[model samples]
Target: MTNNNNISLLTAILFFSILIPLFLSSPPSSSTVSTKTLVLPLKIQKPPIGFLSTSKASNSSNNKLSFRHNVTLTVSLTVGSPPQSVTMVLDTGSELSWLHCKKSPTLNSIYTPLSSSSYTSIPCSSPVCRTRTRDLPIPASCDSRKLCHVSVSYADASSLVGNLAYETFRIGSLTRPGTIFGCMDSGFSSNSDEDAKTTGLIGMNRGSLSFVTQMGFSKFSYCISGQDSSGVLLFGDEKFSWLGPLNYTPFVKISRPLPYFDRVAYSVQLEGIKVAGKLLPIPRSSFVPDHTGAGQTMVDSGTQFTFLLGPVYSALKTEFVRQTRGLATVFEDANFVFQGAMDLCYRVPPNRKGFSDFPAVSLVFTGAEMSVSGDRLLYRVQGMTGKGGDWVYCFTFGNSDLLGIEAFVIGHHHQQNVWMEFDLAKSRVGFAEVRCDLVSQRLGALGLNT
Candidate 1:
């Protein structure tokens, strides 16, 4: 028994002795950094309830869940020393990357730092720990072990708590070493079933701690496909071969210090909104931010539905309802809001095939206009009076006041079939209409299938 114990101790020592060199060795230069462009494939995964028209990654699989009114856009990446695969939601509204630790409740696969030779915990005294929460409202705390810990809480009340650490992240052929992320041991979600499928989230915002900013990438682009197809994600400045004509809009910077407003999010200017080729009566000031930086418009892929500021949304909805009064019966039940947010529902007659006659809604921005037409304007919500094959279609736009947020958010639902380029170098965003599935195929052909 003593001989066996000696042998076990020696084996443990030998394992570390062999791996010590690897831990000290510098990582390979990231392909995302060296290459002019890095492309990663993305796919759309349906939720449990199937299709509710909720506005919404990755190799061959990326799932976005609309459960509990939270829409998440996910991507697949490998992490750690030997590299374990992890599913992370791509959130432009947030500024931090994180992963679920082994102690999480769900039986899904999680990151086990102890098994990773390259995982390095940030000490409480480290500068990285001190400024980790610079862009976030939450502050970093130190545990009894003197390890830097962070707690992240989203707008939906989903929270994650864990130690701050550095690990290697590999996306497609690119590898980013010593990337800082939260190794969350505890997580709380509004819906466990849907959240269980994903390990954590990857923040792609403009903050200092964001993945794109940390990796030193000046530009990134993504094409979000429709419900039935895949898409593509690209990092760096090199343009893709298939990219078409794109309209550009400069990013607006809010220098005003506002405690409640989100400064890290991508903000864009809104000139006006048009419905059925007619402009609404809302004043231009309604779209502008106040002294506190409230009422800014952001393009966030994390949110499933588009949310306009209270007055702006009201004006748009009023104009929209007036335009389509006789086409379909208005669903006027105030208590029957679909998913507790979308209230402008209409019951279409079974004889009518689809809402083809619905007027197109266009969001006019500075130097750019996004047109939402046909099925994209209205979502066919499931389980809404199925008698006689009559379908219920609800307007995709919602009020941001319902979420207690003062800003206008352009969600994932409206980004489908659009090539969106977030250019950091020029401080501008570019958008163009194209088939995202074709983009996905092109990326897959480039050997980014996994």
Candidate 2:
């Protein structure tokens, strides 16, 4: 993630805001009209009392840990009358999938289709259309059927606006029956030259009206293999038992839901730590429940590092330096480190104490607990920035970013099973197992250096 790459990623996001309007004027072919109605198997449920609260559980014995792996689905969006496939980042943090459209007012570097037959736009009045034209700057005369409008905000102070449409969207072996996404008419120009390569983005978070949800499919999962194998998003019953064991966590709804979807919330416990094979002074009281937006854990396969908030970030870095001082060397990279220059390498001395002192990071959930090996937690990704000379383990977006809702982001790539089960009626979240190897393999193939 060089400065050039970061700018490119940002540019791609900004471009969608401008290019969504051009394709709205065209009508869909009669053959493209979908006659099939989609019905999902999983039912949306409510949460139980104190489901997302930080208070102690009444039945502490009921707390259990489950495991599951995070999955990635590649989304391709084609723009214009003759649609063309565009490569984009499928992000759960985002809410819509949009491409560069023909009517874009501003242009830089992007793919536009030469033929009009490839893409289709859903009318504004369509029952599924969740956006309003007034929200966007679109003129009232712009036939809603021709243009699709949508709004999306990110933790990093970035926002997107574009038109929505139904186009051919493919993920692994599954092709959505009739996919609805966004197409940016313009806005994605970049100050840096590298920003132009991206085509669009795909949103895969819970509570999103993504292609998976729009097609009326429930219980969608995928595996993000490490940098070697292309990640796959499983749809319907396309099962893969090799995904290790499946684990589930409850999806906490936001007190105030966003325009297009609900927010996912959860509690995390800092528990304790093991340094040099000895119990450290870390306190259980140090484990406070984070309900602010800044505490959002990005379950993103697209991201390599597991970013933590300010307090956790500081404590982890300090302990790593204290315990591994002999083998570690401070670098100008603004983060603590062992002795390696590249690939987040940390040198471990050949001694019993060295091995015993290895850092063990744990995450305590309501009824379950998970740990990150010292090596993995200390692993670093290229081009990540840190604050006050610390490695970029996680970032703090502050409470404003969350808009008073909590964000537990699962990176598009990571080696863990992340299950999100929402029981609306009981308001209680469940825990599942997370498989690491599967997540590593999936993310590795996508060029993410996790």
TM-score of each: 0.86, 0.56
* Model 1 Cα lDDT, one tens digit per residue, 401-450: 65456677777778899999999889888999888877777677243522
Model 1 residue runs over 4 Å out of place are 1-32, 49-71, 103-107, 349-352, 386-389, 445-450
**Deviation (Å) of 147 in candidate 2:** 4.3
lDDT of each: 0.67, 0.37
Predicted model with the maximum lDDT: 1
Q: Candidate 1 lDDT (Cα, whole model)?
A: 0.67
Q: Using alpha carbons, what is the TM-score of model 1?
A: 0.86
Tell me the TM-score of model 2.
0.56
lDDT per residue for candidate 2 within 359-415, as digits (tens), equals 555555445444555334443322323333333222211111112222232232224
Model 1: lowest-lDDT 10 consecutive positions: 12-21
